[model samples]
Target: MKNYFDFILPTPVLFGPGMAERLPTELRRRGLARALVVTDRGVREAGILNPLLAGLDAAGVTCCVWDGVVSNPDADSVREGIEVAKRNRPDALVAVGGGSTLDTAKAIAGCLAAGVAEVFALREVKDPRASLPVFCLPTTSGTGSEVSYWVVITDRRTHEKVSIGDPALSPTLAVVDPLLTLSLPPRLTLWTGLDALTHAVEAFLSTAASSLSDLLVKEAITLVVKSLSCAVDVGDNLEARGDMALASLLAGAAMQHVGLGLVHAMSHQVGGFYDVHHGLANAILLPHVLKFNAPECPDKMKTLDNLVEGEGFMEWLKRLYEKYALSGEKVEIKEEDIPTMAERARANVNAQTNPRKAEVQDIMELYRKSFKVVE
Candidate 1:
């Protein structure tokens, strides 16, 4: 059987070492004047914001800082961010942290442009236009928010995390400078890198997978396998950092077209409910999800074996998890919570795109295996 697919790569990606140095030029190229710098308090305090501010100042671009973004960026966070952006009326937005900060910036930009305080008003259900141009500078190698069209935001009222995706929200420029990732803590480096790996693996096995996406996923998986450990162990290794960054970009590009799977669907529920880091949740669930899906997609699992190299692909992943200290400690995966989390995962958008047709029971079983609640 012949497979046909459509590919879209709209965001202009600027990748390499020190690419962040070009931020001023990129903003000016977009004809942006006043800019709102969106990021979290952590990154702001890390002193990472200094160089970016210097670049903007050197470019003579008037800018204001909004450092209130929180992890798992909730509705109220977006609303407060929008209020700030509206007051400043910045001509552009510069996102300067990880996925949470970038997602918040994307939402704030869209809401400010639409003149709505409620981000839900601009949800996939609503017809919202693109807002001020957004330029993303990702400090983490996960989530791929810099290149992806999707943004996951939690609605505080319902405690449900819904994703908003529109081509209109894609960043005008993605500055992937490996240097910024060098200071990341080891645990964060491991989690985020694993998240990037999950993106590649899921996209490769997606029912929507195409030849073009497969090419990207193949290379991405290889790079992640080879470099993730080094990047995690030696946080300051620029070469490893560069490889992971490129791997993340390729994975992001692939997911943009092929879509994700049950792992993401299930992970979203955990993130919304627990306020856990998105990458860690994805990491802990990845092996179990792979084990669940492996029976259905043996060929894809074998393809992964080429990168990780073990008696079998799943064993290879298990070994990698052990090697990275990602899988040793036993966390509780309560059988009781399976039904509820499974229901949520089943309802996620990515669930429909999973290669295996997962019934509620199938999802619950997978969740039961994946969840490790400390008890």
Candidate 2:
């Protein structure tokens, strides 16, 4: 336990079926009229966009759609979004996709509100003022961007992910309805659940882990362990999806309170450079990284180990990927790039809080170890 700490989870959240139906009420509560709906093309095609539009329409609310977002969202895309915001100047934003959409919407809203010239500019300023309110209905159970106060915007030119975190960036309201996640394919379901698992596990082992964060982490881990497979298999099961949704929110809240460590520190670089799915990168890298950090957090590791049926938490993590059909997705890692990747990962904001301090060499080793997976 640290003598001093700062803890804040600022998002107001509602979880259940048809929560999106009440989205108009949330907007009305804030006296928001003109709204911007930020989402991707896929969500638009999935027929998800229509209901939100209908809900807003039912309340006589008008919205503009910025549906050009891409999968590994880049800073350039966010800059474009900021331009759109500049033109419409909507009073509120509704993020309606996965992590990428939510993250891009957050940066665009922040930059537009603060009148920052660049999306990256919000990163350097200590005090960020968000002018417009944000409401989110997550279509995916992972990323937790709907609840957390940080966004990862990848730079197209540099192939580096920029993490911008501030209290002003938190969504004013988050509504999660498991019905929204019913259409997710198995691959996405697997990766996102694994991502939630990694978040809880890593936050538990972080040096900043507090009594409050621990309670959430433990529950989050248990929920993921119990409900993830059912959600993936059934895809449309309400109970499983609801449990995973709650688990993801808890894990996101835990990471917000205590922060994450080596797993995310390393995965962010890989996800940025390779354009791989963020959760998949974290799942592939997690076992090796946690095993390396295990000695520094024996008791916590014991707790994690107990979550699995038998011994070896590391083995259980590896088996999880296999069980979920997540192990076969391949990411190409060049031997020459390891040095640069290691340096960047070592520079991650959360690297210092890793239970065991890691050096550049250790990051390189972890990457090399994760280059291939066996089923």
Error of 2 at 131 (Å): 1.1
- lDDT of model 2 at position 264: 91
50: Cα error in model 1, Å: 1.0
Q: Assess each prediction's global lDDT (C-alpha) against the native.
A: 0.84, 0.85
Model 2 misplaced stretches (Cα beyond 4 Å)? 310-312, 372-375
Q: How far is candidate 1 from the true structure (C-alpha RMSD, Å)?
A: 1.9
Q: Model 1: runs farther than 4 Å from truth?
A: 124-126, 328-336, 373-375
Residues 62-180 of candidate 2 have per-residue lDDT tens digits of: 99999978888887788888888888879998999998998888888788778886888887777788788888788998888899889998887887888989999998888988889
Among the numbered candidates, top lDDT falls to: 2
Once model 1 is optimally superposed onto the true structure by TM-score, how far is the C-alpha of residue 11 displaced, in angstroms?
A: 0.8
Per candidate, the number of residue pairs that clash is 3, 0
1-375: candidate 1 lDDT, tens digit per residue = 016877778889989998899999888877887999998888988899899899899998998998999988888889998888878988999999999988888888777767778888776435566678889999999878899878889976665788999887888889999998999888898889888998998998888888899999889888887888899889999999998999889999999888899989988887776676788888888887887788888777777887675466577667777776665134445555566778888989887778788888988766666665443
